[model samples]
Structures are given as structure tokens and as C-alpha cells.
Target chain A: MSCGSSPFGALADDTRRAVLSLLSEHGELTVTQIAEQFTHIGRTAVSMQLRVLRDAGLVKERRAGKYRYYSLRVEPVHEVISFLNSLYGASLDGLARAAEASADQEPAAASDAPDPTGTDKDTPRWGISY
Target chain B: MGNLVLSQQRHLALPPADVFALLGSDRTAGWLFGADYQALRVGALVQFELPLNPDDPNGSTVDAFGRIASLTPPHRLVIDQQSPWVGRLICTLTPVSGGRGTVVRLGVEVPEDAVTWLLRQRGYDPLEEPTPPATVRIGVLTSKSGPASVFAAATENLARMAAAEVNADGGVAGTGHKVHVVLRDDASKPEVGAVQFRRMVAVEGCRAVVTNVTSEVFDAVAPLARRLGALLIYTPVNEGGRFRPGVMRLGERPRGQLRLALPTLVREAGGKRCYLVGNDYVWPRTTNRVARAEIERIGGVVVGEQYRALGTTRFDDLIEDIAAAGADLIVSTFVGSDEARFERQSYAAGLRDTTRTLSLAFDESTREFTGDDAARGVWTTFNYFQELGSDGNTAFLRRYRATFGATAPPLSSITESVYEAIHMLAASGALNTDANLTELVSAVRAQRFSPTWPSAQPEQRRTGEKALYLAESIPGGFRISAN
Candidate 1:
């Protein structure tokens, strides 16, 4: 299925968000399985949501004999996630470089030393692990 | 039981046997933080290779191990972990009605910090972050239908008023979070109350639940509170039991109220023969047991005793038996509308002319429902009465009438306890921080409610608060005894 023009439209509904979270928690689930988790809504309504997600390329549908299974497709949101990762990564790199440059310019100046996370003064604290 | 617990539940559209198959599959490692093992037998080892960074596919991993402590096929599984995530993990699967699905309950007995770390690794925020104040939601569960609905008449109004008052006074102590109250109706049934109680905690995110339902509901939801890591505060007179951690049964016990009311009632009646009548339930049965002991100690003879179904309206036969037994005093443990019906029927039978009745659950709303003619000369015991002559009570009554209008359901000990419970939670400051069970109990013990609230003092150990005043019903309201 094509991701249509805008993926944001498909993410606007509350049920779709919850469906996405459930799909993320469990890698894959059948249409009936998803419907069971949400007793408040019917099977037809869940199928409609899955169809919406499939149309938006947010989830992949697989057919096995008489049953159908659905799983979250990370491709549509992968672009946005990679962009955010780069944004944070670039900011951290720039901060570390700036601190290293300042430390090198004033090697003997105690005030200009970068605050290292470890005991070694050479290691900068700006590397992203989170 | 461990020092901390992390619990989650999911409804699967599969039977318990199928769910057990899924649990034994390798796919579970996806949600269980990379804990991989397909062995379903007891004493099998499971190794955890949890990702250090969930967002990065090639990030370093942390290693831990656990062994299967017990494995009950298609039902329960227990695993004992070592080191970093040191505790036990329990999984239970139960088949739902109609044989269409199963409900899976998972609990991890680990420290709070370790759970927080695990959540963070799973791409979630830290569990104990207090920055950027959150609105503390408290759930109020009261009966709006069925037999005991009358007891909850003022519960919702009083709880909302207390929430508004707490917010106006700068929210819970030390936290700037505004107070939010989520009201739910239990329908006076234990099963419905348990469902609503779970919804309030799991779905609505209520930090603590203040219940104005019967003790039957309390028994149903007490275990759920511990499993869900939320507080259950019950507000009603009860036969106190060995309540579990994370549950605060803040209601008065029947023993204390009986000790205060039976003596005066017996002395005024000028007889030692007493009859006991109540609805069939744990609270009623427990109260009767205490009454039996108290009556014997006070030199009284047990004349006749009987229990009726909760919503039974026909008391003619019971009243006839009570009159035939020649009892001078009667102890009525009937609750809500049942209590009112018994009083009115007894009055109609002319049993009230010679016999004195001491009702354990009678309050202003019930007396109003019973009317002045039938309720007059009836004795009751409680920690609060709207007719209390105190400046704090006067101000409270003024605000209550102004907020709910003059025709609102009259406040009684049962309803007043709901208001006091919210303030008690605020006083303990348990809403702001992740306080442990001991810290919570001690913090609550150190608190004394305002003069407007009841003077009942919470016990040092397990039992709830206790302070009783004997009152007699008059034309308009009740006259609380000086003692």
C-alpha cells in the first residue's frame, strides 16, 4: 500500500495510536487478536483502522491461508526518526567539538577545561548514549 | 512479596492454552526486553541480552540471567532473576468468558529504580520524574445503583468539593500539581466495583482510589490495588481485616461503634435481651460476631438473630419474629435502603413502641429517607453528624449547601469519610512522590484531619480509624450525646 500524501492524517485518531502501541509491543497480531484486545470496539472497526494504517503504509498486512496478520511498518516513520536522530547527533557533535576547541586553545586554563563525565579530563561529557 | 513490583495486563483473542504457547515462543523476547528462552519447564535458565540503547540496533547489551521457578501449564509461570534485575517475575493467564480469549497478567518483583531503568531502555521516560508538575488524579468509586446506592448520595459531591478545596489550597503538599477527581459508579456489586476499580487505576491513571462502596467491593479490589501499584482507600464502617500493603481501609470498625452504642441502648431499654438483624455479607456477619461478644460482656442475652438478602424489602416476618422473641433492644446492621426499610416496617408493626433499635449504618440521608416519624427514638453511632455544634462544621455546612444547594443529600459519617480521605492523602504527601508502603503508612499516621473532619484517629498498625459518638434520632435531625 502507498503511504498516501500525508502520514500525519492517519496518526490523528486515538484508536490508531493505541493500535500502533499494541502492534509495537507485540511484533504481530491477527485482526481477530487485535479486536480481542479492544472489546469496546468491534472487529469491523479494527479492520477499518488496519486498512487505514495499511493505506498510509504505516502497517503491513500478510495473508496465511484463511487468516490475516498485521504488523507495524517502520518505513513511513523511519525518515522522521532518522532526521531527529541526526538533529540530536549533530547538536551533540557540535557541542563536543566546541568544548574540545576551547580546551585546546587554553590548555593551562583550569576554567576553560571541559567537564568530563569520567575521571579522565580528556573525555568530553557530550557523547550521546541515551 | 518483593520491595517493588511492575505489573501489566493484556487481553489476547486466544485461549489460555494458546496464550501459553505464545509465552513459550521466541517472539516474547521482543516485548520482554530481549530476555530469550523458549524452555517452558521448571528450573530452565533464561538469559537476558537487553539493549543499552533501544533506538540503536548495534548498541551494546547488558547481560543477566533468571531461572524458571515454577511452570503450571496454560495457567501460571514464575521466574527468579539475579543481579541487575534481582527479583521474581510471575505470569498468569486465565481464559475469559465465551471461550474467545484469555487475560494475561504479568508482574515483576524488582526495585523501583531497576524498573525505571528497564522502562527507559524500552524507549520510555523514567518512572519517577517529578519535573513539570502533573495533575494528580484520584478516583472516587461510589454506588449509583442497586441496593446500596443511597449511601453514595453525597459521596461524589463531597469528593469533588474536597478536590476543589485542595487545589485552591495550592494542591498536595510540596507538589504544585492540581488535584483531579475521577468519579465512577460501582452499582453496589463487588464484580462491577472490581472492574471499575481496575479501570480507574489502569486506564484513567488515578494515583489513589477513594471508595465509598461497601466492604464487599473492598475485598474484591484490595488485591488489585497491590498488583497495580495504586492505593485503595475504603470509606465506610467495616469489620477490619488483615489488609494488604497499598490498601488503606480508613473506615471505622464495627467493634468500636458497637462498644459505644450497645451499652447506652441497653440501659435505656431496661432489658438484657437483644435481637440482631442485618444483610448477608462479610461486614454484617463480622459486626454480629463482635456484637455477640459485646452483648455477653455487657450482661445481655442474645434473643434472636437472622440475616436477609441485601435488597430484601419484606421485613414483616422478621419483625414479627423479633417482637415474638420479646427482645427489649435490637442491633440492626442493615445498610443503605435496607436499613431505612427495616426501620419503617418495624415502626409500622408498632415494634418501636416498646423496643429500642440501634442501627450500625444509619445516617442523615437514611433517616431522611425513613422519615421523622419512623426514625425518631432510633439510636445510631458515627464520628460525624451535620448537627455538630462547632465553628468548623458550621463553615463546612455553609460551603456544602452553597456548593450543592440546600437540598443536597445530607452529609453523614459515611459520606464525610470520602472528603477526609482526600485530605488525608494530601496530608501524607504520598501523591507527590513514589513513597514506599512503610513511608506511606508512617506519613498518614502522622496526620490529623482538620476540625471540620471527623476526630477519628488512625490506628498505629493495620486497623482503620476509630472514634464513635452515640446519637438519637429526633424530628428534624439527630442529637449527638455529650459523651
Candidate 2:
């Protein structure tokens, strides 16, 4: 299968992502050559990993001397860069959510203190100071 | 470059195998903990609360966590540790190797905030006059307040006693180095502990810190020690399984404890049906994981195990479940206040009527807190106690009673191990003058340290050459069992 515009997240697994590192570290290694870095696994496993990286546009491949050589095409990291930007936004949004949660819990706590009148302080804020 | 990403960034030339190898390096793990000593390194994620508290034991107690931002190379690591306490935090690691060994000093500069600059107060001189290169400084970053305050009291005394003994005799191998200890309070919080540790190294000129508080606190300090190029002496929950190079763990590693205790427990129970309980967290989580594995390995069955939330005050529901398990033994790891609560409640639930309990954490202080009546019939195991051994123990007990008052520091297992950590470190530090962290580390690794061991080999069989001994609760204190 080929990587679509929205398939960026699918390429995040170790096998797919590590392909670039393997190629870059060794410089233009064949599927077999790249597989040497991950020798604990089988050669076909390495080829499948390389396929994912090629689909992600994170690796460039060519047939040389009857063997397939894969090189790093790091241009796709720009998409990863955007994904990381989104991650930062999500993290900040999480912080904001946490802030709102604490803010909401505060009045519930304060209202239980008992108002000056005979009413319970936390009697559902129908009116607001703001 | 390889995956040797222990520093922030890679040189882009190292291979993954080399990087992975470095990851497993003790030297690498040492720098991973703290970056306090040198000017700083690139991608050096040292946790520094710049604006620190001078009087408080732990420096600006910031709950710090972060990822390595950028590894610049050669002598600098820029760690991106952002926390509530730090608006901007950068730890710079620079090697200041005066001679053969590198003096990695971590310089933490706060360019953005003044709320966090708790360096040594100007003109205060947090450290003493510089001694020669051969001297060794060990600080006790203890807690006088907070949850761990009780344990810290004995640990501080223990460390001091060990230093006193080392200095009184000929200091380590005629290195002629005097052992000095500085006490700082962690308030039982890791943030506080990390900060205090930073200040102790940066200001007080300490090279090592010894503690056995918690995995949370230990984790916090461990990373910081790497940043500072100092060593942390740990008496971890499972003795010292986490014993890396710069990090040295002394007693009863959880694996070692189980290796010894589980088999004995199975033999004593006459079968493998076991009930386990812990104050649900790191210590118990690890203990149960190892326990379950051991039980399966030994062809035993774990009937019931309950891990309660930390700070849980009651264990009635858990005990009820434990009682229903029909198990022969109850294994536990409840520490501090929860320990007492668990014991008293377990006794109240009448679980003891059917089950024989074996504890991994109860000791003299725990019994004192829970009342011996409630703690009675509970069998506890540990590495050391004042009651365990001979002339050394008698002298230690006499001095401890005299120092803390007869009723205080009743020689609990945790405190005794911590006390022994100090004695061992001081003894090794004095003998070692290679003056490198690794040398002192090797010395500690080579030393057999059970300050309270009686007749057994320096290492007990149960905790694997640990002073780990078992005793059943009596009316007064624990009695070291012959079994």
C-alpha cells in the first residue's frame, strides 16, 4: 500500500521510522545491507520495513547491481514537523483544559464554606461577578 | 550517528549499536541522572530550580520532567526540562578535567526568571574552604518534614555515624581524606530532594549523596546526579538491582529478597498458595511483578494480591479479600503511615486467624507506630537491626539510644540499611583516591556492608549476600529467627 496525505501517523512505528536511520548511518545500503543493522530479524522483515519508509517518502530507493539500495529522503520530516506542531498545540490545550477543570472545582470547594446568609455558599451560581 | 543519545543530540556519525552500547554504559547512566558539576553539556536535561531556597533542605522543589532538546557536542548538552517552577531551564554540561579524570560541572543559568535563582546567598559561602583534591564530601539530603521525615532522621544519624567511625579510624586506604556530610531537607518530595541535591553539590561541594526513600525520589535524584557528575548511594527497595556504575544500591533488592524470601515462604507455608498486598505504587508494583514471576517459576499459586493507592488510610476491604483467598501467607510492602494502618487493620479483620503473614517492610518503628499488640504475629524480614548481631550491634544500639533518646530510632530495617549505606560509602571513599566516581563506585561494590549483621556471611542467602534476616514480632521488638 502507498502512503496517502493523511497516512503520516501510520508511519510512526519503529520499523517504518528506523529505516531512515539505518540508511543514513550506513549510506546507500541495499535492502540486505540495511537489514544488517537489524540482524536479529529476518531479511524479508527488513524489506517490508523499507517498503513502509519508501511509501512514507522518508526513503529513496533504486536498483543498482541487481540489488535494491535505499537512501534517506528526509524531506518528509517536514510533515512530521507539522505533526509535532500539532502535538505542541494539543499539549497546550491539555494544560488549558486542566486549568479550566481546576477553576471549575474551586468554586464548588469555596461554596461549601457557608455564605453569610442562611444559604449554602455553593447554591449553584446563577449570577456571576464578571 | 548511532543511537548513543544519552546526550541531547548525536554527532551524526555514531552507529545505533555504539549508541545503544553507550546507553547501557554505567558512565552514561551516571551522567543521565544529574548535571550539576561542570559548566554544562548540550542537550543536557539537568533539572535545576534556579531560584532556590537556602534554608530548605531541597532546593526549589520543582516537579521537573522533560526530554533531551539538543545535544550540541564535545562538552555541552542543552536539556529542555520545563516545569511549573522553571519558565526556562537549560542545563549545560562542560568537562573540567583538571587531570586524568573529567570534572563534569553542570552550570544552570536562568536568563528569563528571577523567581527561581536560589543559588547560595551572596557572601554566605554555602561551602567550606576548598580542601585538597583527595578529600571526599558526602551530603545527606534528608527530610525533617514531610512523609519521609521519620526515616530521614535515622538515615542522617546513620550516615553521620558511619563517617564518624571512618574518620576516627584511618580514613580510606590512607587517602587521608576526611568524610564530610551536609544535611538538607527534601520535605518528602522529589522536587525538593532534587533541588536540595543540586545546591548541596553546587554550593556545599559534596561529591556524593546517600538515600533510600522512594523510587519517585530516587528517580528524581538519580537523573540529577548524572548532571552533577556525582554519585548517588541508593538502598533501593530491591536492594540494589538498579545498581548501575554511578548509582550503587546496597540492600535487599526486590529480586534478591524474593529469591530468598519466596522459596522460604513456600516451604514454610507447605504450599504455594500466597496472598500479597502492597500500598499500590512503584515498590509494591515491582515487588508483585517479581513475586508473581517467582511463584509461577516455583510452581506456586498466588491466591490474592491487593495493591492499595498510596496514602490509603484503610485496608479493611483489602484484608477481607485477603482472608477469603484461603492462602497460607500474606506478603506485604506498605511503608510509613500506611504500614501501621495496614497492620492494625489486618489484625482487626481477623485474617491472622487463618493466614500466617510475612512482611517485606515492617520493622521496629513500624511496630512502634502500629503498637506491638497489633503488629504481633507479623513476621518481617530485613537486612539489619540493632538486635540482630553482636558487639557492633550492641554499640550501635547503645549509641543510637543515647543520641536519639532511648525510645527513638528503634533500629528499623530501612534506617539500618541507610545507616549501613553511609558507613560503607565513608569507608570506601576514604580508601579511594583515584578520586573518580567510578573508583569510589567500585570500592562500594567491592565492600560487603551490613553494619548490623550478626553471625551470617556478610551477605545473607535470602537477599543474596545481603544482611537480610527474618524475625517474628515479640512483645518488645523483633527476634531474629533461627529458621
Which candidate leads the pack in TM-score? 1
- iRMSD values, candidates in order: 22.5, 26.6
Give lDDT: candidate 2, residue A99: 25
- Residue B318's lDDT within candidate 2 is 82
Query: Which pairs of residues clash in candidate 1, taking residues 3 or more apart in a chain or in different chains?
Result: none
Question: How far out, in Å, is residue A16 in model 2?
Answer: 44
Candidate 2's C-alpha runs over 4 A off are A1-130, B1-136, B170-173, B239-243, B263-272, B402-404, B429-434, B449-464
* Residue-level lDDT tens digits of model 1 in B280-398: 98899899999999999989999999999877878999999999999999999998878888998999999987799999889887786676788987999887788877666777888
RMSD of 1: 27.6
Q: List DockQ for all candidates.
A: 0.01, 0.03
**Count of clashing residue pairs in every prediction:** 0, 65
Residue B427 C-alpha lDDT in model 1:
62
lDDT (tens digit, per residue) of candidate 1 on A31-106:
8999888968999999998887787567899899999989877564333333323322332232233333433444
Sequence-dependent TM-score of model 1: 0.58
CAPRI-wise, candidate 2 is incorrect
